[model samples]
Target: MLRFAPSPTGDMHIGNLRAAIFNYIIAKQKGEKFLIRIEDTDFSRNIEGKDTEILSILNLFGLLWDELVYQSHNFERHRNFADYLIKHDKAFYCYCTKEFLEKKKQEALDLRIPFRYDDAWAEIQKKDNPKPVVRLRGSFEPISFYDEIKGRLEFYPNELDSFVILREDGIPTYNFACACDDMIYDISFIVRGEDHVSNTPKQILIQKSLDYQKQLGYAHLPIILGESGKKMSKRDSASSVSWLLGQGFLPQAIINYLIGMGNHTPVEIFTLKDALEWFDIANIAKSPVKFDLKRLRYVNREHLKRLNESEFSLLLQTQDITIGALGKLYLEEASTLNEIREKLGLIFSPKDIDVTYEGESFKEECLKLFEVLWGMSMQGESFIEYESFKNEAMKRSALKGKKFFKPLRILLTGESHGVDLNELYPYLRFYFKDILRIKGEK
Candidate 1:
């Protein structure tokens, strides 16, 4: 069995999404039962809709699970486990206040020493005192575990603070809450990011104290870095999955890009179904993976090219990039939806033609060409005869190449270089009169 547990505190970061993907892939590969556990015990940060949003995004990527569990729903079970530890003398309650701990931590920092918990309060009894927080009575000896990815890892229990199990507010801390739920859910494999390496030992302690019979295997994937080799942040491009989706990125592209990070494969373009066939746990890379926007764009382009015409049309409609008959044509030429949107900018928001030529005085020639095109359109001609238009313009003005097409291109699309106006004539003819009425068009 495997579990993809996420806290509903904020938008699902790309790193967390990758972890979920790894877990889901392993679960499917092993034919094991998969579950999604919502760790929403932290009332302070747990937003209302974030849980739904997390599940929605997972579903969008086609990562499904067998069951859904909320960690808060098992609050009584968590308390009971803590009580069992307390009865076994494996944990104790500390009456330390926040201010007291902060001052102690600062003093340790000033002394350039580690701040291990001085659970001295366990030896004393102060009746009528404030509520106490339950703490694990960790050993002074070293504790070790074998991680599937990182291999043998060791942690000195003396160096680790006797971290809180339950707060005075009767809320279980993350380590305690997650460990209890994993035991309850019978999670056999624990896959997470490298950042959670430190927390693993603490969780192991809690798991042992609870007497979970089954052994838990762990695989901590390498951290994902930004292009600058630092941790990813919102300032980075496409850092937020929701923002990426809103920007018209297909979910398949995101999934392919993420899987490609760790997998050693010759192929760049692959679907989730293809990924399931190729996924191997041993193939996951140990080095940090860097997030590159250019690579993501390449992946997006590949996915765009794979979409059939009807699928492409539906995608455009869903994104509200409707351009009538021209949209389908643009989709054929565009490598990405963003590219289609860029090319269709003029159609969406028409601008006055900037007919200011660099030096040539070809306004008269361009005006004659427009006059001919408008007359033909007004006569119910829906298509442009490019050769005929060019011949008449050249015969009238004795101009060709850049001098001839450059000015007309600028007038047509408000730009000098873009989609060939000759091929775009069928669509641009509807806007020919509108382009001719621009203030600067001669």
Candidate 2:
């Protein structure tokens, strides 16, 4: 079994999405159940509907889970496990006030030592105290676990000190909630960023004290670094999955870039369906990878080329198949839907012919060329050879050279200079009526 327990906090970060993908792929490979556990117990911080947004994004990327659950729904079960530890003398309540604990923590800093819980606090009974927080009676012994990607890992006893499990208000801390739920769900393996490595030993302690015997699997990949070599922030480009999708980055491209990080693959570019065959955690790079937004654009371009005409149309948000087909012509110069839309807008948008655009020197010729084309334009929506049409228009207008091509070029492609007319016209030919005559015109 595998689970992705994300909080409904803001938009889903790129890191969490990568974690979810790794877990889903592994589960699918092993024919095991994959589950989504929305860790929404921290009601104070959770953003409403962000959970739905997360699932929808996962679906957009084709990551279908075998089961789904909310961590808050298991609140009673979490409390019960905490109680069991208390009854077994594995944990006890501490009446230390927030100010008091802060003083002790600061004192540790003064002494230049790590803050470990003062055992004396538990002995002090305060009648004024509200519901006290529960703390584990941690042992002074080394704990270790094997990580699938990182290999053998261990934590020393001095580093693993007694910590709070549940707050005075009956709210479980992250380590407590996550550990309890992992056991409750009978999860077989865990895959998350390397930042969570320290928390692994603490979670292991929770299960050991409760006599839960399952040895959980773990794979902690190196955390992604921003260009500044710091952890990702909102300032970073790839920080928000929602923002990336909104910017017209293909989900397949994002998946391709992420999967290829620190892992060997059969190909540089592949669909999610193709990844299922060659993905292996053992091949993943154990080093931190830099998230490059530029590389995503390059990958996006490759995916754009793979798209058929219908997909091109959908990418541009158009029902007109001609507009969609024309979008493909701009693919060589565009990597995103937004970019292609700009190109389509340049072409399909009714060209406003200003005879004076070329100055009075050629204004008369421009006017004559426009009249000739408009008169012969709006033909049957069938294809027309560009040379024949342009040549005849030039003959009728009695204009050639600079006078001929410039006016015709502006009329066809909204640009006075660009790819030759022969290359653009065939794909754009269907939209002649749309381009030549303004709307509400004869």
Candidate 3:
């Protein structure tokens, strides 16, 4: 079985969705069970309805999990395992207070020694009164594991501390709980973000102590970073799935863009079916995938172009627009929705578009072009025939240059560049006739 354990902390970001999608594809391809585990162990960080939002977004991308599990509900099971580890001498209780550990760390730095909790301190606590925070016992030698993507990795035991397994609050830390859950659920493959690579050895240690080593395989997917080379945050406008959805990006387009990131492939666009067929853990790139908004836009545009007319119409309807109205204006002369979408931006709400042009002559030409387009509409002829008339008017005005195209563009679409005039005019004829009429009056 495969599992995607997402923390219910905030909105589902693109990186989180990519992880879930990859796990979903692997499960479907292998005919294995895929489960959703809500890791809400940290009650302080949990947000209301975060799980619902996560589930909703996953459903939007057609990624469904077979079972839903909550880590909080498994507290007793984790505690039982932690007790068993202590009984077997695989873990020990430490009563080291925060101030003691901080001072010890500072002393080690002063001596230029490694700044990890020493087991010697564990002995001192054992002699003194111990508050009993469980800690996993580490070997004197190195611990290593074969990561599916990163290959063989080794970590020295001395380099790591006798890290807490069960915290002072009696709650299992992430490593202990995650290992216990994976074992109990019989999760055969563990696929998660590469940031958890360091935690693998510790988890592996717990699994080994519990004798469940052969039952699990580990694969760490690379991180998705922003163009600035930092982990993407909610503040980054393009980071969240909901943000992209609100911006009219199709879920499949986002999935396709994610699949292409980090992986070496010529496939710039993919459907969910295509992804399931092609997703291979071995082929996943080890390097970080840079998130580029421009690349995403291009990929989304390609996917949008491939949608059938009915599908395209449904997408528009979701935003409260009608296909019949769209067709009456844009497709009266064009044959496909792809063409309509290409020109549909002209009818988008002003706040939705980013227009950039600043010159008197450019503004004048745009206004003049709007006047001509307006003239054609008032004449009661279809806007489809306005292109030729526009050309003649441009020639007569001796403004038939790039300057002439600008103001017309601004007037038609409220933008300086997008959806050529020829295709844009018809769409405006249907959706934004009133807006154009208002522009004409000005």
Candidate 4:
């Protein structure tokens, strides 16, 4: 069994989605059970709609899990585990107030030494009856564990303080809740980001104290860095899955981009089903993966090209009529659906098309060229094809180069460059002729 745990604090950024993909793919490829556990014990920071959004995103990417568990549902179990620790002398409650701990922390800082709670608190607790916070009694010796990604690692228990299991607010801390749930849920494997490495030993200590000696596999994935070479964050707008989707990125394209991040595969364009055949833990790179938008756009464009005519048309229709009509015109020219939409918008919603003259007879020649092209189309000639029209227009107008095509391009698009008028010729002819007739320029 494997689990993908995420806190419902905010929308999942790109890195979060990638981690989920890693765990999800591994589970499916191995024929094992995959589970989703919402680590929502930190209720103060939980956003209202984040939980639903997380599940929606997972479904959007086709990451279905066999079971769903919410941590808050097991609050009683968590409290009982803390009490069990206390009964077994593996943990104890300390009545130290916040102010008292703060003063002790400051004194330790002044001495330039690390602060580990003196177990002397345990001796004092035997004589006093005071409301207290439960703290786990970690071993004085070093704790070691094997990591699938980073290999073997060791940590001295003294490097950490006797951390809290149950806060004074009667809430279980994250490590405690995660440890208890992992064991109870029978999770055989744990996949998480490298930042969680520090918490592993503490969880291990808690498990050992409970006399649960079964060892599970752990894989701490490397971090994902942004374009600036720093850790990806929400402020980096492009790093957001919602933002990417809203920009007209297909879900498969996003999945491909993320899967390629650590998989180190040469196959650029692939579907999620295709990826299932070769997904392996050995292929994942230990180095941090860089988030590159240029590569992502290239990947999206490749996926777009693979869509059949009906699929392409349906996707366009879902967005807008202009896109549905003009999308195929510039399909090859666009790297993203957003690019196609923007181009169609420019054609349909132009502010103005200013005519530029390269010669004294440019306007006359251009209008005459348009009339000839329309006449040829009406006469059932091949002028509907841009190449045939351009050849005929050049011969008939006795014009060459930009003096001929540039004026026509500007008149149709109101821009210097865009989807080649050749590919756009059929759609543009009727629309342009209607506009010319309406404006009395025909």
Question: Largest lDDT belongs to which candidate?
Answer: 2
Query: Tens digit of lDDT per residue, candidate 1, span 1-442?
Result: 8998899987788888888988998898889988999988888888999999999999999999899989889999999999999999889988877777788889989999988778785434446457888998876678688888778999986657678999988889999998888888888898899889999888888888777767788889888898999988768756788888887788999999998986786687998888888877667788888888878877887787776656776776753222434555664456567677676665434444434546445556556555665565577755357666657655655567877787567556655666666766666666666655444334
Summarize candidate 4's per-residue lDDT along 163-230 as a digit string, tens digits: 88998788999999999998998878787889999999989888888888889888888888999999
Best by TM-score: 2
Note the Cα lDDT for every prediction shown.
0.77, 0.83, 0.74, 0.79
List TM-score per model, in order. 0.87, 0.92, 0.81, 0.87
Q: For model 3, how does the per-residue alpha-carbon lDDT over 1-442 read when each residue is reduced to its tens digit?
A: 9999999998887877888887888889889999999999999999999989888888888887899999999999999998898899888888777777899989989999888877667756555555668898875678787778888888987756678889888999999999999888888887888889889888878888876757467788888788798987778988988888877677888888888887865466779898776777778888877898878777776776676656666766644345534533443434333445555554553422123476343545555555665565566755345567567657645675567776556666656665456754544555444546333233
Error of 4 at 34 (Å): 1.7
| Pairwise lDDT winner, candidates 1 and 3 | 1
lDDT of 4: 0.79
lDDT of 2 by residue, 1-442 (tens): 9988888988888989899999999898888999999989888999989999999999999989888999888878889999999999999999888888899899999999989886678756567586789998785788999998889998988887788999989988899999998998889999998989999999999999999899999999888888788888877757899999988899999998888877789988998878888788878888888888878889998998898888777767777777777777777677888887776676766655643453534445656776777677644423378888777887889988888888787777765666677878887666676777432346
Q: What is the descending TM-score order? A: 2, 1, 4, 3
Off by over 4 Å in 3: 123-130, 213-215, 231-235, 318-358, 361-412, 415-418, 430-435, 439-442
By lDDT, highest first, what's the ranking? 2, 4, 1, 3
Off by over 4 Å in 2: 352-368, 378-383, 398-403, 417-420, 437-442
Clashes of 4: 0
**lDDT of model 4, residue 78:** 94
Which pairs of residues collide in model 2?
Answer: 262-285
